[model samples]
Target: MSLENTRHPAGPGLDELVPSRYALRVGDIDVLVVSDGILSLPTKMLAHDADPAVRAAWLKDMFLPPEMVDWALNVVVVRSGDRTILVDAGWGADPNLPRAGRLAQRLEAAGIDLGSVTDVVLTHMHMDHIGGLLVDGIKDRLRPDLRIHVAAAEVEFWASPDFSRTSMPPGFPDALRTAAKRFLNEYRSQLRLFEEKCEVAPGVVATRTGGHTPGHSVVRLASGGDRLTFAGDAVFTVGFEHPDWHNGFEHFPEESARVRVRLLRELAETGELLVATHMPFPSVGHVAVAGDVFRWIPAIWDY
Candidate 1:
């Protein structure tokens, strides 16, 4: 239901109107899943190559609307030892996506101060992943010495980016390019470019798995006997069942599919907790091997 039509107790802040964050632990690390808000987009973007009938059936089975969908935007905060790391900033202010760009306010509501963050591990340079840092005065709030970790290949790719395969709505290509360029130009001095992987904290490592983008990466957290993965945009709600489906926004659809399958297989084999950028709120779940396809087993809320 639309928020306008749905009833709720009076509240001034968005976080109070509805839940915006979830806290959990991984070995010795603390993780908080925060909502940047949501994006409403055409359902065709979900799988541009799928047969209309098949895609329709899948959406119907999932109980999602056939024409449009509200995609969740989740940003993760990881705290380990003396460092607090931000994983993928949300779209700070996209004129087209008014519902999103709530990460700054949401982070504050979650008690995560911007200046307190020591590092940022980016999965890619997608607008939704880096636009929050570009928000007005965001740089002032962040410590000048903050380290931003991202794949060197990702930086290189955006410099001469190609969008021959994507099937986005009008204006998205230009918007994405502009946002990525602006972010890099603004944060070039703070970037800690890595070729393959980099240890962001005591227990967090971001590994490049070029598929969705040349520099797309996933962060893995391990400590003691517990493990979790912040998959960024590498995984999604529909990825488990249709790993081969080409998301319209994927730069390399085939490679993205391969990466998705491989990641799903590894997560299933290891039985690690998985959190992704576009899954439902508090996207904490486990991957399971269900015959030939994978299944998403959401974790029971600790509360």
Candidate 2:
């Protein structure tokens, strides 16, 4: 699949609509990469105990430019037999965040509408990923018909009355308290939680991969002997380069590392395409195990 960005009225200070990236098809599923803009952060901000040489090597390997790293929010849309499943909603219209709020238009560009989405698979409840779930009209609001699929632990944690006020770890912000609270308040009733591993549908299975959040998950799509995994935040930017690097945004840093290490090994050993929400554009690639380390080999497609 190819991405084409058409011009649309800027939401606030933006000049034009941003383009999207497409990962084409995997057997019966069509994966559309929707761009929700990007976030710029310093390398050190990702990890507190970063080793200088390892960090530099990771940056070099990923072809990351110096100074800052900009991560694009790549939302995944899966069109299988009869399912129009959206992996995660992008950040919605926020005046302060001009780069975001383009998922709706991007979806239209990919020939999809909010109403056409049959199921929503939320990996976790991060602001940038879940902000677009609600229709934010200036005065009135519109809610789409979507049966949200989430990890039972995640739903329970975020929906708990005390979750919002609970203090987060060092790297996390207090404002996450408020945002998560709002998300739960608005969508709790609409959410359907699943256990460790379950078939969300015919060929779509929800895999248990946590640590980024209490109940973060990765999705597996299998058809005709082919499989693809939609990994939410299981792996971060540095992890793409240095699989050992632990991202600070994780709810449980050590647990996240353990899961990623094992998951990456399995993915490489299987030689299947993996889609990440923040692993460059299109974010679909295969893993190559090099001795004890791993490399991300991006899928080639005609633009």
Candidate 3:
């Protein structure tokens, strides 16, 4: 596979509508990369406290604006045999994040019915990752067949009494805790929690790689001889080049950096396809050791 250096246009006021879906066949399993839309985060909000000059240089090299970073909200959908699994729910019609909440639309474009999703494997309880699980404040439990899988430690951490006291911007932690509780209560019967590593589906396994959040995880899918890892925010493109540059949203920045480096090295050596949730639209790629750090070579459009 040849690497293509395709630079996506970036700036304010640009039309946000781009191809929001991509398809790949991993042996017998079908995988789809769906977009919820783009999120415009101030460059400073990410990799916070890093030297401004260093951050600006990296942005310049990547052709991104130094003031703001536009990140694609990529969600993974997996269909293995009889199961239709969604990796992470997108922002889902959230009023605060007007640009996002388009996952339902993109799923329809990909010919996936919302009712057909058998399982939702969440990497963590971040709003963007779990917001789409509900529609109009209602969990789609009428189907009775839909199940939600998350890490046990994640649920414990968020549900703990002290979770709301975490050092976060004013009401953010409280809001997060509320959202998590709502999701858990709404899907209580359908909720399943795993620890360390365990199979979530026939060809899918969830491995705990906490750092970004207390119980953040990455899901691996294998069928026949092909493998793919849904690396849910383990790092972004910039993180590959500088694993030490921590995201401001990380619960444990130091541990997040350590996990990022370890995972990147392992992914590079194994040569498995990695799908990052916040890289670029269709954030599927391969990792490679580049000098002292790592590099991301995006997978060619497999459509």
Candidate 4:
């Protein structure tokens, strides 16, 4: 049902130490999870509103560093009915972020060509989720008529994105603004704006869930009774134990919390597979309700 290779470093001459892709099946659809690499961010961004001591304790308990966290950027590729859908693009370019932005080379290594992607379903326009599309020569390599699906509200919000409630690091707000504006100008013609939900393929659906951003959304894939939801930024690693904790990048922290709790509950009840953007690499897992909070149960790799 799933295939992943994480043995040791690559044989030889490969820049990456290990394979960065995970493959699985949701009924008839083939899904591949690729790592765009990791982002090193401040630990406080994980929960800006939480008590500092408590937050630090939580990180300590998890054996994570108190000052910084390496958040994983997981992107997915889906194949269904002649359609190749890219769920989200990873980081593109940042002089300070050399560790991230490996989506393009990794995709090629996985044998997927840029021109074969029929559609790009953006969870939202946040740089990490859309920046790979901005990389040099990326546009020329992609099919000229490739369709990009995004929530209408998301596109509208970025026209003049308001970061009033967010709590990002010093240079993030301005950087985000620039990337979003550039993406809009370059891809306006390719955008296929949807009001609420859109079907990217036969069994893949993208539904707008306004919280993190006005049009942030999650992709749900269902086929022959198998289900998996790619919850893009709707939930983080700490969210299960403390769904109320507000992540700094959230434009509407309170609303983001509400969305996280709702989505977590729904996943728990359904007992379906869950993959999130910022969870550890190979983020495939299941959700379970534990007393008052939820729990993440990582699925064993099929290998």
Backbone clashes for every candidate come to 0, 1, 0, 0
- Model 4 worst lDDT run, 10 consecutive residues: 1-10
**Residue ranges of candidate 1 with Cα displaced over 4 Å:** 1-14
- lDDT, candidate 3, 53-132, per-residue tens: 98888889889898877878989888887788889998777677788888876665555667778888999988779888
lDDT of 2: 0.71
lDDT of each: 0.89, 0.71, 0.79, 0.92
For candidate 2, write residues 135-157 as lDDT tens digits.
46511222355678888888776
| Candidates by TM-score, descending order | 4, 1, 3, 2
Better of 2 and 4 by lDDT: 4
Each candidate's TM vs. the true structure? 0.95, 0.85, 0.89, 0.96
Residue 114 of model 1: what lDDT? 90
Best by lDDT: 4
Q: Best-fitting candidate, measured by TM-score?
A: 4
Q: Single out the weakest 10-residue window by summed lDDT for candidate 1.
A: 1-10
**Candidate 3 vs. true structure, TM-score:** 0.89
Runs in model 3 deviating more than 4 A are 1-17, 161-171
**Candidate 2 regions off by >4 Å?**
1-19, 60-66, 138-145, 159-172
